[model samples]
Target: MANEKITEEEVESISSFARISLDDDEIEDLVPQLNEILDYFDKIDEADTEGVEPLFGVHGKKNVFRDDDVGESMSQETALQNAEKTEDGYFKSPRVRD
Candidate 1:
């Protein structure tokens, strides 16, 4: 067999750190799959990116939010008009805990 990039012991350690319970069969299966994923990352490392500018985000627009201008404020009577239950200018709800 070719050189094993990830051993069974390493898989056990990773599963323990991730708080995951893995049987012997699952650990055996994960060793090869994790090594394959690492190999793909190795291939990606070989890519040429000398002159390429780092892209922070896909969106072209920066700070697309409207101005936070204060407008006309609603009266307290108008705000509590549609409430099913109101107590002293605030909405009242059922008791959450004993």
Candidate 2:
């Protein structure tokens, strides 16, 4: 792990790839932190994983969705009955984004 080194150039390249800009101070601070992270990975690589099955996910791949069926849907009037604001039988709200 001591042999692991994170160069400023590599840090600059990584920041550029992420579409973010970092000044000299930030890059200097980040180099040691990045090396520490790599050291942690080196420690993790030392773990004994013998006879351990690879984990994909805790949940299985089986479908858990309910079957879709045609049923009596709510009418427009019924849907908008409790709304504080409605326009042409539709629920109206403030714009979410520009």
RMSD of 2: 6.2
Q: Model 2 over residues 27-69: C-alpha lDDT tens digits?
A: 9999889999988898999999999998877887666788898
List lDDT for all candidates, in order: 0.89, 0.89
Q: Where does candidate 1 have its weakest 10-residue lDDT segment?
A: 54-63
Note the residue pairs that clash in candidate 2.
Answer: none
Each model's number of backbone clashes? 0, 0
C-alpha TM-scores of all predictions: 0.57, 0.57
**Per-residue alpha-carbon lDDT of model 1 for 1-98, expressed as tens digits?**
26678999998998898889999999988888888888889899999999999887798777689999999999989998999999998988899863
The alpha-carbon deviation from the true structure for residue 29 of candidate 1, after best TM-score superposition, in angstroms, is 0.5
Q: Which runs in model 2 stand beyond 4 Å of their true positions? A: 61-98
Query: RMSD to native for every prediction?
Result: 7.5, 6.2
The count of backbone overlaps in candidate 2 is: 0
